[model samples]
Target: MVLDKFNSVRMLNTDALQADFVIVGGGISGVCAAITAARQGLKVVLIQDRPVLGGNGSSEIRLWMLGATSHMGNNNRWAREGGVIDEIMVENTFRNPEGNPIIFDSVMLDKVVSEPNITLLLNTCVYEVKKSAGHKIESVRGFCSQNSTMYEVTAPLFCDASGDGVVGFLAGAPYRMGAESREEFGEKFAPAEDYGELLGHSLYFYTKDTGQPVKYVAPSYAMDVTKTVPRFRSFNAKEHGCKLWWVEYGGDLDTVHDTEQIKWELWKVIYGAWDYIKNSGKYPEAETMTLEWVGCIPGKRESRRFEGDYMLIQQDVIEQRHHEDAVSYGGWSIDLHPAAGVFGEESACNQWHSKGVYQIPYRCLYSRGIENLFFAGRIISVSHVAFGSTRVMATSAHSAQAVAVAAAMCLEENISPREVYSLGKVSELQKRLSRMGQYIPDMKIRDEENLVKKATLAASSEYHFKGFPADGEMQALDESVAQMIPLHKGDRLGKVKVGLFVSEETLLEVELRVSSKPFNHTPDVTLETKTVSLCQGKQQLELTFEAVMPEEQYVFLVFKKNPLVQLQYTKERITGVLSVFNTINEAVSNFGKQTPKEDIGIEEFEFWCPKRRPGGHNIAVQSEKDCYVFSVSNIDNGIDRPVQSPNAWVAELNDPAPALTVRWDSAVRIGKMSLFFDTDYDQPMETVQMTHPENQMPFCVEKYKIYDGEGRLVYEKTDNHQSINEFVFPEKLVTDEIKIVLEHPSDLIPAALFAVKCYE
Candidate 1:
């Protein structure tokens, strides 16, 4: 190697590259955008300032990824975001069930690099942007510190996913920081100046046990918890990482420019908290415990929100307003943090839940003025109050997916981003996204080319409305419990029988409840309430409600709280069915019910949530007559999850070999096939800090085989653990008939499929 010695100043090595799409910041949103665009055959360049991807979810700053399935603590059932983010989540759960941040980093890297169309540049920061005529971005300049190289990447379309809107700012995109006035958007939930304007930044640390006495020396900059932190007494040696989410600062200051200052304050607070645990003598249990790992970088929550054609406001979320250009959905509550952050006297956050998930319009994804620019992550177009709900990682990633697909379409048509909406192409975009497993509320996949749509479908056996067998443990009715059973329109739920064990003779109260809205899962409207006397023994009680369902939806057979009574649970796991208990899960701030002040502009509703796996058994209940709809035609309903109805065809529990056959009058050619399976969308697969009991979902299909018209095996798969299984044939498959044979996930669980699509 020859070393260069020059009298003149030498510049860094410069490289020029061109791509169809250029995305700055390798966060979850950017990663998802790159993967999606790459999958659509676009040459993409993904740039990251950090060494690894997953911005907030990276090992350097480990924050759990969450979205619509808000910790599974709210009434939004089966509300997980889909598409590339869904694949990443399912893959993370399968490979890193333990939720190691390092492993998660690898998972992100693996996904991005696995796509040949994507070129990832880690440890690279974009500092310059070049714009062309007509307000379009032509290129961006970035530098990699490790390689000491300057890269000028030119692309037709550009996306800004950086946490602070770096590219958007440099490109002169109009944006707003902090809160908007209540009168501006008529948002009553908007924060007052005294309360807070902008949400703050948070830093987290992890601790572990050393199995011996360990000591720690606080740095000179370490803060004094007793003096500086008002909530210092709340600190416990057991709490670590994101559990200390309240350990935040930098909201009152310039979050973007003063990030370093904020990070220093966070570090001081963390060290001081640890010092109190080790030196304060308040915890004898901490003697053997020591600091295991600390986050190097802080997880930033909010900064500058850029402008788009439409700015999502408070009412859009609370009212569950539908958007014709809807591309994604969000269910997280309107969460806001105080500007004073960890040092504030106010509550750490104020969250208000809506009745159901709301649609995110495509107009809010791309910049309003910048013709070629797109917005992703926390920087998307929304009012400050609405940002509280749309700022989560999963929601951001899901929205960014819309950008990826739009960018691909733009490149193909040689048009601007706004033209995709103005030209009436939103429906086609929605259909494409749904086919790729992106869930859009009230939107159905209308792919006319799907071969299954024109074929006759039949299943070997269908699951009738029978009660779950009493095979699991008994659960005490300390809190209200409800079994979510699906009922069709005009169907009458006559009499129901439930197995219960009573300690003493007591009065039992039962109620039949449903949501005021059809798509909502909240059991707010009570149809009928009945009171019955119980004896002190294990017996089946008959509950006669005789309530007629006006519309097709999931009704709750609610059992009121009774300490003396215990309900029987069954081990069977079925798609679109679950048991919810009215209780407190402080993690997501669900305290059994939300009783907000009437003037706060927030509605009051009870929160009935399901438990995690290895538990959350179904309640054993039998109906006098079958009312559930589980037909073979459901497999072609264009819906992949349970919405107003159970959109799945489930085989009977006793069927030894479950099979579904499709027949066509004439032979059809299929070049690709996609299968949708049950993966329990209710389970919020948090990427970090949460450990799951099993590597794969118990309801996911593990084995299946597909046969053609000639009774010859076309394809077979085993060890399947994902919700969407896709196969592309090198040679087209021509057949007049197709058969699918499946093995039950377990003896107690039935075989279920949401939808099937065969495309040419």
Candidate 2:
């Protein structure tokens, strides 16, 4: 084979093209920079040396995307955001439902190509950089494999997101290659006195289960597996899907300098280990599972670092120092992989820090010498010891967000990276980040509005009914009877009742509906007799009722039950007297009934049937635990009260029915509220509506409800049904009370409303 080199220097037309910014390296950081700039309406050109976009996480390497932030359900802090990363996640979740690595790579590639503003040059390598006077980068030249052509890319600004800091190195920027001495940076994990060897890299692989016997062949030059000790092991195969081992660290070669050599050694170790497992016959089923990957590119933990405006040191991390320019945060402990030359020892050389978080400043993202250039990802300026903590992909992604935003700001303001550090511009950048949902605790927006109002009710030692008078004198059943009242149970009551009265002059056209699950057994307490006479303009009405106590609880009254009461009774010494009558006034008129009948009179209703539990009559008391209350008064729209269902008759009812209207005296502000309904018997959720009352608009609602078996509505609301009407929140609200009317239009089991959450 003959190596071909055409020429050392090639001239290209400079005036042919122009861009506001140019990004080198199509990794996550570079892509994010380009995307961020483009989203701000800036012209951007992204150049990549490889066919794929993701640097470490790509099909070429098959490395999993790990970050400090939660992706899917993985809760890693400093969760990053760039439309590009979000696009990749969304596409991956759709294309590869199983989340296969190969498909994930494809999703990443799609995002790069789909961005209209991004011009991606694949299979291209940047060879040289040309600068103008005074160390300002002029143009970058690269060799394109696809066209077999060399081109010059000239832009006002450039970003080096390459994991190895290749562009910054060629640009003659100040940088550090290895760890600093313990005394130099005062880093606890640093080498004794001087910077020397660095943490080596690793080549990760995985295997899948096929439930059949298989065999693995060891490489002829493979190291003996019996001699190597496992570093990381997981025995719970079911939890992790399968067994995984990350045993060896160093291959006795510089990962960046001798990548090919390290890859070869890793391949041998993988096959050799598998061969040992297969030959041992300890895992008969292991034969079916094959090595899914060899050494995809070696993942380097340490490399060249571009000197930035500020050098983040280990002390800064260990001290938990806060900076006005803090643009990102990292939580991973200080983990230093064993250095080269320390191999095959009983005690692996490593250092671990206590659980703590660190703040990384924005000044560390730009090149110190290269005024027009910025650096992000693993190559940011930091001592090797500090880099150990910041090198994690999640932190790197956060750094990428900082770099992208700064780059865009630089382009828009016609300034350089150095200018961003002046006049508190860096802090401004940090503020912009905080506004974008980046977790910067110092500038957090907290909810301070009081959601519940303070109220004091008159205490009753003996039952002195205040609202109305009965024809017969009331008898005191027991002293403990007052304690059974839900309102007397202290501040934390699960539910409370508010009375609503309409006079003869008031014409009510209200729609009352409860947003929570309805109850079965009607309360034995009567609200009509409990109502007070209204003075034309205003009237105060009070109702006395009991709520089964669980523990000390907070309760809020949203609605009151009219013509409803609860009965409390206990077993007596007299035998065979198993039932008691807790009745209301005989003359009190029922809503739909023209004349009250003796049998239809309000009486003690038992929650549980006798067949279910014999002699358990005390458990049959019908209180707030057995029914939901909703009311419509002349003053406002409606009120809703969610009660616990003890009778279990309404336990199967998933949605709230439209029985009456709830009117509020004034427009109430609801910051956030959710309505849950049962759609299917299995899922039983029909719909969920979350709205902001102050804005008088819907935040989100689920339309297509889920159902369960037996045609019961499982999930009442569907995703499509739920939608945010507007992004902006208004000051005032249209209606104080939100009416949730359940309609069982479909031939499915009646859906029940489980809960409603109102957050201010």
Candidate 3:
């Protein structure tokens, strides 16, 4: 088109988009938030600054995702995070077992892009937040440099999944940066002196074997080859992304504003560190290895945190306090790193584990000042000390899912997030979240839509001779392993059943110990040790302990090593058990190690309490109210986690051709039904999980068949790979009774299943 030749100049195009929810950030939290909200039937716009999904876990940063289930993998039996992140882990495990960072990135993008209700905008950074009246956020503006467009997105609600909490920042929301003083939040883990310092950013590098000797040249801008930075002993050719987690910086300065400078320093650090490893002759094994990739963008650990309705603190975590509105559980230790970062001298940070799983309330997820604003990820309302545990990505993702569901409830009810909390609608929110596969510690499901809730059990599943299924295959626990056994006021303990192996004549000292701090989940206080000698071979031995019991105290059973004697260990990684090392020669220590060298939660080694002849327990198909025996029967307990003992159901191991039937009260129109099968709750589904038994996961219905009333065959499935199996019928089936004929997956072990529900 011919226009007047008026001074032509480049124009800035501003595009406006409207959605029900505007989520800023593409981190796991943001991804989960968007997915959860979108799945709940809300139009969502997810703006992420990076080209790819996964904030820290992306190929750019490559920080491994560790969450409420601490990486150490001890006493975290069922602490694996579920929700949206669980789906990612399962898919990633199946698709990218080698743990390729790029594949993981693709996995995240596929999930985000596949959601029909989600408009995922990658490489778009949301910088400005527009707030309307009454503490409400009207919209946010993001600049996408790739398309050279500025998007002004308006929504009824906003979520700051941005790790930096930028949306909340611009919305004038009350937020806290850096560490609060000890007196500010009464946090015991807070620094003795007040400081506006936060955890630092980290840089990492990957190396690959070239198969031939490769020479390296150091960049001129690289730091000193060996002088400025330390850690000579830890730096090895084998160590890569996660092993070098301590390569951090930029905590002393402003992490957000001074990002470029930090990035520069990190780049130089990686080069110089690699130079030292290759040229300085420190690592001899580097001769054939070459640097494959180096990260330019630093992974941030701490930044601006929004002030929400409640500030989670140290007392809540250590005391294992139960919240009425507890929406998520955090089992990770209080891991607070110093600001000195890579230049620091001592170990990374001060880590303190919780005695048991702690609760994260819904109150801390929404803005206190910004009425329509909600937050997830590391930016949730928590003191720096409390943030130590909640900052992990998995925990943050759980928080994201919680807020997203809450946001849906808000949108449906036409109320603010604050109203959801003030009106005591948290219970309803918790019920909804649990129904969606979120684990709320003390919550129970009461959904009227759960058709299984009304069904009466008319089945064949043998009762008695039932107990918690054993995680197949156990090895000798040569290391120090202990469990945080709960003791009542009158409980007595004298002996424990242990699988012991001896290579030569040796003795092992067994003892019971308690955590040094009454609240800490560590076994540093030794009560006593009993020594027993053994000969060469494996034996089921009964280790005796003095009848020394304390009132309502958390204690650990300590086993000392004799080199020749090794106790049998199962990789189950059971909850309530802890592994203690380095305590043998230390005067004072924080348990053995918070997450010393493991990526999974602490290992559940084999050490059993001596019992009289295994009287065992029973699992009967009772009323639907009490479905899974040995498990608390309720709507709240879904397969998100295996409820420790008997997942509340009988395995038809000893029965002949078992068939469990659900007789409904009346004809219920059902087109889709969901069956939650047990997938070895004792093991973990998280990427951090280590076990991979050859057989199918415990209680997984490898093969099953379904039938309607009148014994009409309706459905049959074989070799199912997923835990949550869903069946959608082309035409809705109006039936009063539905039956499942269980074909035991194993002849020795019962084919155990969890929950069965129908959706209309």
Candidate 4:
């Protein structure tokens, strides 16, 4: 043990530890990375600076998990992240449907603890690095304030899931920060001039009604909103939690280095805003509401992004560019926030979506210079323009899973992260990922062991392939409709197509307005509009309006309310779409209703009564109008999962025992059979903010039986969760025919099965 003190610095003795992989940061990305590696039989040590997991989604920060599937919206379609993130999202929905923060923390922690190979060290900050020759990492030293322990962790592989890319920064990996110029990435949305500004940091607060009258007092540090804060004067006492993502600051300064100052400044603003709500004569409704929670940690949006072999740019996202080594995908939109933070009067940020979700490549997951350094989360190698979409937690988590799988391959191949690209190990890596249910855009199952591909699918019940329709149900003429219309980045508003119904001859006016800011959904800035008269009947209307704008956070296409007319919409709640009965009426849009609300159908997101109890859905897809789920077979014709359901064998069931019997032309030795069940493909996963309950879906196959070619019962199971189920045999079943006898299909929709395969 050695101790040294120099001037004003003190160093203490350190402990030594070793693992196959060391993950810095416990955010979704890091957590998923650690789990993936550990699950693949690698030893891992995960170091989180904070006391809890989930990073931004932690109770300390409380930002909900956002990802590749933009809440099952138009852009991303059926995309919900798979692997560990999907597990968390599904579990969180069932156990913590209210999207409770502490519950989310526990869920994430439980997942980490479930992995025996993962060594989790919470409240440990990795501060130093040790590198050896060959440009490879040797070890990293982290300090734990909880126990005053300085520990050195050594690993052959390292992943910087840390959102700030701290490991890459310490390892001398080349990186970039702040906005790029239009000339740098050929991004039209990029600032015409280069700037050292970035998306800001944000703070949030929580408030609850005391039930009885409650008084408020201002702290000494609370700024007087009427004087100190002038730009945002609207301090509604009821608004709290993540609904206030706009309470942002610190973009103009160094978001990483100046984080403390930003925290202090955000504290002032949050406290001041609370004080203004209680002390100011703004409203009498504030009398009963009490300050419930104030954040100590600020939720940071952007920071240092490490350099990788290929830097993804805006055009890649805008054009939905196809990368040869595509590994993961993102579709959250190019969500760029303003540099001025909260003080700026400009739109909070600029955002543009792609035609659809775009592919993220393998080259961007590992460092270009640092031999063993790989990164996930917001730090992945992407231009500032591309980061807007890749930086979300879900996309980063997918990258982490990709890194974890690649790290396993690296261990197997005895190669550096750079070498994997050169040796063409990416295809194998992609195969491994998809077999595990991670959806890589355009990547499909092509393995010869997928025996079902060569078999004849026979079922007792017939699955009538209905042509998918744009509109499923007739909505009642109850309220005005305004949907968030997203455009590909830098694209203009060419037109909008909507399904409408008129009970009698009626006149209707549609208005398109740009979202006020990047951080919120309230519409402002009128664009183009039109008025149309329709005869009594159902009609598909196309409203063509021209507008000039770089991009939009979101656009509001407000359809005027008419008593005699109604619009068509899937009652199933689609992600990314926000429904408003009337923003002006407090009752119409209150986050906290006077009484606890009931679990309404995805239909509640609609202004009309939620009547549809979804029988089966991948998610309520807004487009890709086909009666049957699109491109269900493994062959990809541009559209796949999230945009279309997987190629699955489904049946329309009325028989007591319905079955899908796979028969090959000849007998084949089969020792084991695996199946990926059809859980709700369109699972509306939410982390902390939701109006509905996440429950253990009954839509899965609850019971099933297996039979041999002779129709002899071989295996049977009842009460199942839709995870991959594998049946193994001591000796190979030398038969070409196998059958699945299914019972009690939930939701009464089509009985569906995904990824059926036989392996020896």
What value of lDDT does candidate 1 attain over all alpha carbons?
A: 0.91
lDDT of 3 by residue, 646-722 (tens): 33354445677766777877888888887766554333333421223232443466788888887788889987745
List residue ranges in candidate 4 displaced over 4 A. 1-14, 192-196, 466-474, 477-502, 506-563, 566-646, 664-673, 697-699, 707-736, 744-748
Between candidates 1 and 3, which one is better according to lDDT?
1
Q: What is the TM-score of each candidate against the true structure?
A: 0.99, 0.57, 0.83, 0.79
Error of 4 at 158 (Å): 0.8
Highest TM-score model number: 1
Better lDDT candidate (2, 4):
4
TM-score of predicted structure 2 = 0.57
Pick the winner on lDDT between candidates 1 and 4: 1
Query: What overall lDDT goes with each candidate model?
Result: 0.91, 0.47, 0.69, 0.70
What's the lDDT of the predicted structure labeled candidate 3? 0.69
Candidate 4 RMSD to the correct structure: 9.4
**Angstrom error at residue 630, model 2:** 23
The all-Cα superposition gives candidate 3 an RMSD in Å to the true structure of 6.7
